[model samples]
Target: MDSQQPKQPKVLWLNVIVFTVTFAVAAIGTPLWAWHHGFDLAQFIMLGVAFTFTGMSITAGYHRLWSHKAYEANSVLKVIFALGGAFAIQNSILHWASDHRIHHRHVDDNDVDPYSANRGFWYSHIGWMLRDYQRNRYADYTNCRDLQKDKIVMWQHKYYLPLVLLTNFGIPLVFGVLHGDIWGALILIGFTRLVLNHHTTFFINSLAHIWGKQPYTNKNSARDNGFLALLTFGEGYHNFHHIFENDYRNGIHWWQFDPTKWLIKAGSWVGLTTKLRITPEERIEKAKATMLLTRLKTRLSVSDENQRRIQLIQFEYDALLARMTDYYAMKKRFFDLKKRRLLKKYERADLLNQLQKMKSELQQQRKTWYSLAASYSY
Candidate 1:
């Protein structure tokens, strides 16, 4: 078969029909009905609350906790996430994590990647789900063996249909009845909230790859965009997440809008989450430095500069990277020594002295590295 004209898998009529009808209801029905009979403040408020719960479930629970094992959540939290996942109307945790693992493992490969963004925006965003392009891929969820072992995950997968109906409809109906407006709640919270959640999550696979800066690595299409992160519950930091998949936080900085990371951290305080994985700060800085050096080299390659000048800059870049490597190595050793000191009954003065010396050396090395890096721009 021609590479461009690959065999089209069977169409998923259920998904096709559901997405179409819901989208129509959200787009046309919402405006028409609202215009005729405006929904009350309570219904709008319910939509916002429902959106937050379901969206965070996917980000903090499914994506970070289950899919990447970035952190461990207690059984109660897991059950809550399961219910939220069903309410969000995404597939079962097993299936969602399986496709995600494949996407990360074979990103940009149209043949294997369940939703290769390189195919096009629409295709990556929603087209992949519309057609059964990889029917067996979803069925063969061996990639999600770890998740399958999770009781909450397995239980949700086994009873996903009933749970979906219960959360999606039951919750809305209950809220509507309490608010004395079943139709209003269903339209606002049910249709509008679901449609918004679906599209925002889909943006990570589509727009995240297309727009934004690739500061960490350009090996794949993923890019980091703060704007997208705000919409997708901090998933907009796609480039960082792609490079540091196991890190519990996508938005590494404190100021980054990663509510999911905040939720996970908050859960830990109450014994609801544990073992949150985090990338070392030095490693993240090193990745950024390496990408900068790569960019500079590419620029020099296409420049009409003197050979001697280019060689000089290249030498400086290599030296800075070597210094950075040494600094991180020393820092690692210092941390290891500190860990040993804390764990062991006896604390040696000499060990503490050595750690302090290493820490000072690392600080000096970091200063030198930054100075050298700054010189390149001049």
Candidate 2:
């Protein structure tokens, strides 16, 4: 008898039609309409507004707030995100978060990961959605039990289809009525915005894995790409995200283009969000230092006169990590004392001085380590 072949999952014609129709309208219909009818400033503005709102909803609301629980959001804020997520047409929070949690847990596992990039770019990007590859697991939202407790998340899940219809059509129709350009609003704000949101978010799954540097880790295919960050509302820092999955901020530098982080931070000021989780600076620095030292060690191993160079590099690495440990330890103590409000004025001043001195010493050690690491890169 011949061995049985595994059955392929059937194609989801609804997903195919939705993806095909929206893309066709956005790419082909939009420009053709614009060439004859022309777009005004308001139409373009509506496009920009819709695009930003929906993208932020996905990055900040869906990925960070619901999926990772990186921070706590108030009921009102959660409601807005729920509505915006529906408008974005990326599925309900329960479904998206369930898939995302699985993706993180089994990232590159082709057989398990929902959008495993290891399967190839097209599959990770959009092909995963075009079929019933998940089978009965489509309704298996066990990973999202916490999100199920949130009234906003549950309401969205229960009424998701109607919510999708309401926001997707209602917003565009409202914009159309107000702007007195119904077709222009639908084409630009509705179809075009949807296409852009879908693909750019998909880039985080596909291109983010294929391109950019893996400064934090190489365990998975995820990489950090600045250009993708700009396109995806600051989600391009995928390497960091994979390792530090619960950190509310992806682009952890002040100069990085993480508007999503900024929006969440801004919300905290008005009490819209709280308990924003972050990876400690010590942990982040240690990761970078470890990766750099590994590369330096590899490069040095190839040199004929590497004994002394290797010894020096090892010495610097040890010293840097030691100083880092002490600095963060003292910094933590300083904060604890400050928070408790039990320190005498002079004692507080003494601790502050100690922290400053340790910080300066750590900075000097870091500079020496980096200088040494850079010299051997060639």
Candidate 3:
């Protein structure tokens, strides 16, 4: 269903009540309470708790687990994350994920992309939500059938309104009542924190497309901004994500501080997630190869080394792909033979040893290509 000029009933109410009440309370109630009483730190604590739960839930739970399916989570983890996301006051998992999949599928398409970058910053930031946009809001359940089957996701989707209100307002008020500072809680934790969270998440949708290096595919508008990545729990690498959506990590390098990736990896230790798919190193090398060719093409008319550089990168990429295929084939055969379980114990153990050698060669080829790329680059 497409959004018309008619008002969005739910967003209308939420915007009026939450936004108005929050700001009004912050502006009027805070000063009134402070004037009557002494300084208090209760609201700040509520704000901290709100930031922690909401931020983690968005990055780890909603975006990665539910939207991207980077990995699966246990029921306890799922519920906890859903609760945390609710506290953030964003849409429910179903609503957010469906929109996101559509966004990725038709990014920059004026009609379909919810926050299409081509429409300009103002439209992409929060303007899309302020209007009815009833034209683009009906989420296609086909893309989210997996999420549909999940009980927690359904629960969160069905009871989204109350959960959002509870986490956004009720939780803070409870803290305020306990600490005897109702206004402070409403202001700092409820309003200010919500405002800040809104921008941080929206930054990925707006600022990310507007600035930074398009080091991967230029087909999309997404760009990688390291500084933004720091603010967005590593989602600032928008260019890489648009290119490599299936990778478990956004910040693929060791230095990039993607806490969401770290969280999921850590959870794997406790058996909460499995088959955590990662893009093959060879595939990443191909992306780098594409980036090299793209840069070379752009620099061709200006530079003398353009042709040589592109040629070297292509050759190195092909060689790396060949080596990677051989390694995987060898490893798979050894594993398959061993898994038959009919093999003698000693023979199965020998197969494992052979597979280990192939892995070492894979590592060596990876390094060889990396050195080649680095050494050639000026």
Candidate 4:
């Protein structure tokens, strides 16, 4: 008897039809209608504002809060995110989180990752949604069980269709009526904004994985692209996010253009968000140092150099690694002592003294490590 698995269906007609119609309306219909009807300043401004809110909703609310649980949001913020996500029309928060969790868990695995770039740019970008090949992938939302408990998430999933219709059509129609240019608002704010949002977000899965540098880790296909971050509200820092998924911020640096991180931070000030998780600076630095050393070692191994030169480089590298390990260990102990000072005021003085000594030692180790690493031309 044959035990081969049956091939899953290839075409998802509803998704294909909806995507095709929306793209056609935005690409062909909107421009022609805009030329004929002439959109007003109010319509354009509405498009910009709506686009920002909907996009951030997905980044800050859906991706960070629901998918990764990077931070906790107040009820009001969660509801707003849910509504904004619905307006974005990506899908319900539950479904989106489930798929995203799966993507992270099985990144680059063609068989498991929902939008694995290994399947090609088109498949990762938009082609995956156009087929039912991964039909059973999200059936069990085991990864997103925490999200399933949220009332807002379950509510949005239950009435996602209605919410989508109301936000996608109702909001535009209401605004269009007020602006006295229903068609203009509908074409510009409705169709055009949706297409822009969809494609920009999709670019994170496609171009983000293909382009840019991988400073954090090369184990995955994720890359960090500042240009793409500008387009996707800072989601283009894919390399860092892939390696450190729980960090609230994608762009770890101050000037990395991550509006989502800013929004969440602002929310915390107003009591709308809490527990914004951050990866320790030492761990991040260690990862970078490790990657650099690994690359240098790989290069040295392949070079057809004399034994004396290879041995010298290897000795220097070993010394650098030792300093790095000591620096991180001392840094961790310093932080642990600092954290303890908050709870035990009686030990504050001694902890401070130890922290100072540890800081000085860590600095010396780091200096030695960098000097040794810089000596190598590669």
Provide the RMSD of all predictions against the true structure, rounded to 1 decimal: 3.1, 1.7, 5.0, 3.4
Which of the two, 1 or 2, has more TM-score? 2
lDDT for each residue of candidate 3 in 56-148, tens digit (9 for 90 to 100): 799888888888888888998999999988888888899889889889999999888988989889879877777666454564577898989
Q: How high is the CA lDDT of each candidate model?
A: 0.87, 0.93, 0.79, 0.86
Write one digit per residue (lDDT tens) for candidate 4, span 199-312. Answer: 999999999999999888999999999999999999999999999999999999998999999999999999999999999876787687666666656555445563455565
| Candidate 1 weakest ten by summed lDDT | 343-352
Top candidate when judged by lDDT against the true structure: 2
Q: 1-378 in candidate 2: lDDT tens per residue?
A: 999998878999999999999999999999899899999998998899999999999999999999998999999988988999999999999999988998999999999999999999999999999999888775658887787778889899999999999989999999899889898888999999999999999999999999999898878999999999999999999999999999999999999999999999999999999999999999999988988888778777656579789889999999999999999999999999889998899999999999999999999999999999889899
Which pairs clash inside model 4?
none
User: Which ranges in model 3 have alpha carbons more than 4 Å from their true place?
Assistant: 1-45, 136-140, 302-317, 320-378
Q: Candidate 3 vs candidate 4: which has greater lDDT? A: 4
| TM-score of each candidate structure, all chains considered together | 0.90, 0.96, 0.79, 0.89
What is the overall TM-score of model 2 with all chains considered together? 0.96
Question: Candidate 2: lDDT of 369?
Answer: 96
* Ranking of candidates on lDDT, top first: 2, 1, 4, 3
Using lDDT as the yardstick, the better of models 1 and 4 is: 1
Candidate 1, residues 22-92: lDDT per residue as tens digits? 99999999999899999878888889899999999999988999889999999999999999999999999
- In what order do the candidates fall by TM-score, top score first? 2, 1, 4, 3
